[model samples]
Target: MPEQVRISLDAMGGDHAPDMVVAGAEIALKRLPHLKFLMYGDQARIKPLLDNCPELAAVTEIRHATQEVTMDDKPSVALRQRRDSSMRLAINAVKEGDAQGVVSAGNTGALMAMAKFVLKTLPGIDRPAIATYMPTQRGETIMLDLGANIECNEDNLVQFALLGEVFARVLYGIEKPSVGLLNVGIEELKGNESVKKAASILREIDLPIQFAGFVEGDDLAKGTVDVIVTDGFTGNVALKTAEGTARLLVHFLRETFRSSFWAKIGYLLARRSLQRFRERMDPRRYNGAMLLGLNGIAVKSHGGTDALGFSNAIGVCHDLIANRLNETIKAEIASFEAEMSKAEAKNPDNVPEDTAQ
Candidate 1:
């Protein structure tokens, strides 16, 4: 049998804490026999949930954490002030090698702050970006820096593209994934100064992946490119907008179908296709955001996630751990660094700061 992958979960991190979190843990344990979970939170609250699942109780362990970090709290302050908060404890578990990965539905800002502080960045990476996959007509596209760092420079955008490319290649099994810079227009001269500068740099570099030029917001759901790169602020806005629009469209469709007997007949005729479409677009299927370029494995879920969402997040963590994503990313980054070093040595003065070792 394969060795078990242990995960540290923040049982009190989300809006539906202790219930959804505990329920997700139970589902994960049931689905993955070789998976062990360490739940961190108040024992009193967690114990009652665990009582219903004796099998999970046998394999899972609970670690006591007294403090809780709220979404409104400043990330830096929470990280510094709350020594025993569930988020901190869960991250510490990964840092200390007690768990192979950490899963949380906690305050994203605080989680990112604490993760950067604890896990640190890989050698060539200046900053860690949160990457998430979304289902699209073509398949799925990897979008990065989703609300992790709002303000980014041209160099930051380039790094996010490279990181996102490697992530798509590894996680989605795409060979030489095509990377696209999120822009307002597809023309080379379009977008702001930062986008223009990044595009110029991207054109100059000869990366292992394919650079597909610029992609607009509408191109995201169409999967016009394999990887989409942008600053956290833009990426976050685009993601939330897509999610909200999908929800709204689904609601409108359901209301239209239920309005009349004729509409009900039409709905029944298209129900199978609609069901498949809904399944493909369901946010629960893609619930976790990966903190790429970090040394350790850290997966973040939506703060308002329910049990199904949390369970899917655990499954994502399991897949990442099983696939040895950290090792693969490290190797890819090392290769990129070596290539950059060689290029710099040959042309020292002209080497771009973004690609320079």
Candidate 2:
């Protein structure tokens, strides 16, 4: 870890407001003692909460933000109008080098817009992709473009693949993580023109990536690859579907155990195993969604999450900052660009036939 990891928190952004935000910071502080927070929110509401936690207050600096961005606020409006809102100010902390990263349980679109406008994309990166890890049968897998860009071209998909690869390497500690493009089928002839073209580029690109030709939706949970890349529309739908399925499974198990006396006895006999399963499936364990490819680290927490979930989001920011994720991604992208230039020089005729069109 660095000497200190200063994180900016949008204290009034989430549904629970300054209360949950302060509680989460206190919890995160216990775990990561090196953390210092630049809390941005209405001081009138936040200061009293912080006053209750003397230890957290000792390490935090509150920056009063008069404006507040609601969940329903449009990204364009938040970016243009709410410059001093808690969300924007927190992000600005990172951009201004006052903080290493920013965390917000606020408007997703607004956060993404402000982060892009403020921090901007890294070198050689066109668009930033929202990435997060999910528990899989094998372990955990990283996936990207989870509702960031609704519509994507082949170039965008390709960029997401590279970004996801870097994420797996940095966050998951997988040196040669396999990358796959989400498709309807694994066949070469499957998927839309964008994915097909992206697959084609990934297949022939001179990068040191393990390109798993194609993977279907089922492969996501099957742990078929370490990284799954797709457009935001499909990715967001898949994410919500998986979340609903996890909750449904938990509900079914609870109802089954409580349905009959014998079932309760059975649950008692298997309670330990069930508890492990529940912990593994808990959404709070995976609450942070990383807004990748930005010049600085920015993590978006679930707007409706509790203190524990928000603390996990803070932990995500800690891990990303400690691992120097952005610097590694920048170097890797530069190397990839260099390799592409070499390929172009060698095949001036037609090696890279613009398939992204």
Candidate 3:
């Protein structure tokens, strides 16, 4: 680990203000004593909360900001009008080298707009993708485009594949990770033009990626592929459907357990197993959604998540900084662009005749 990894927090962005933010910082510090937080928000609101956790207060330095971006605020409005807001300041810390990353349970659009404007995307990247982890049968898998870009082209999908590949390799240390396109079927003719073209290009690329063809909705939870690439629309729909299904299953399970006297007895005996299942399904463990492809790390926590969930978001930022994820992504992108450029130079008019149109 580096000497230190400091994180900037938008204390007033979430449903719970300074209290949950400060408490979450305390919880994160317990696990990462070396972690430092630049708390940006109303100092009067946060100082009292810090008083309750004296140790956390020692490592945290508060920066007073009277303004805050509310949930209803438009991304454009927040970016243009709220320069002194807590969210903007936290992101500015990253650009200014005061922190490696920023975590916020703030307005998603505002946060994204401000972050993009401030940190900017890395070279060779058109738009940043939102990535998050999901528990799978084998272990855990990372998925991208969780509602960042609504529409994408062949190049966009291919770039998302690259994004996910670097994330898995750096975060999980997977030597060679398999990538798949989310589609209706596994056939070559499946999906729209963008996905088909993306798949075709991935097959012929000289990259060190294991392209696993196309995967349907069923393959997501089966751990069918290490990374599933798709446009933001499909990815967001898939995410919401999965979440709704999980909630329905939980409700049915709870009712089933309450159905009979014998069921309660069975539940008592299997309590530990059920508890483990609950822990695996806990949304708090997967609280942070990363705005991948930025020059600096920016993680967005769920707006309504509690203190425990916010702490997990901070941990995600910590992991990214400690692993130098942006640097790794930059290196891969440079290699990818260089190889493609060499291929173009081989053509007479620098036009890829065999390339997909």
List, residue by residue over 238-317, the lDDT tens digit for candidate 3. Answer: 98788889899999999999999999999999999999999999989989999999989999999888899999999989
- Per-model TM-score on C-alpha atoms: 0.94, 0.97, 0.96
The number of the candidate with the highest TM-score is 2
Off by over 4 Å in 2: 353-357
- Model 1: per-residue lDDT, tens digit, 65-153? 99988888799898799779988999999999999999999999999999899989877788999999998888898899898888888
Per-candidate clashes, comma-separated: 0, 0, 0
Q: In model 2, what are the clashing residue pairs, if there are any?
A: none
Worst 10 residues of 3 by lDDT: 348-357
Off by over 4 Å in 1: 352-357
lDDT of the candidates, in the order given: 0.87, 0.92, 0.90
Best by lDDT: 2
For residue 356, model 2's alpha carbon misses the true position, in angstroms, by 9.2
Clashes of 1: 0
Better of 2 and 3 by lDDT: 2
Descending-TM-score candidate ranking: 2, 3, 1
Q: Work out candidate 2's RMSD over C-alphas.
A: 1.5
Specify the poorest-scoring 10-residue window by lDDT in model 1. 348-357
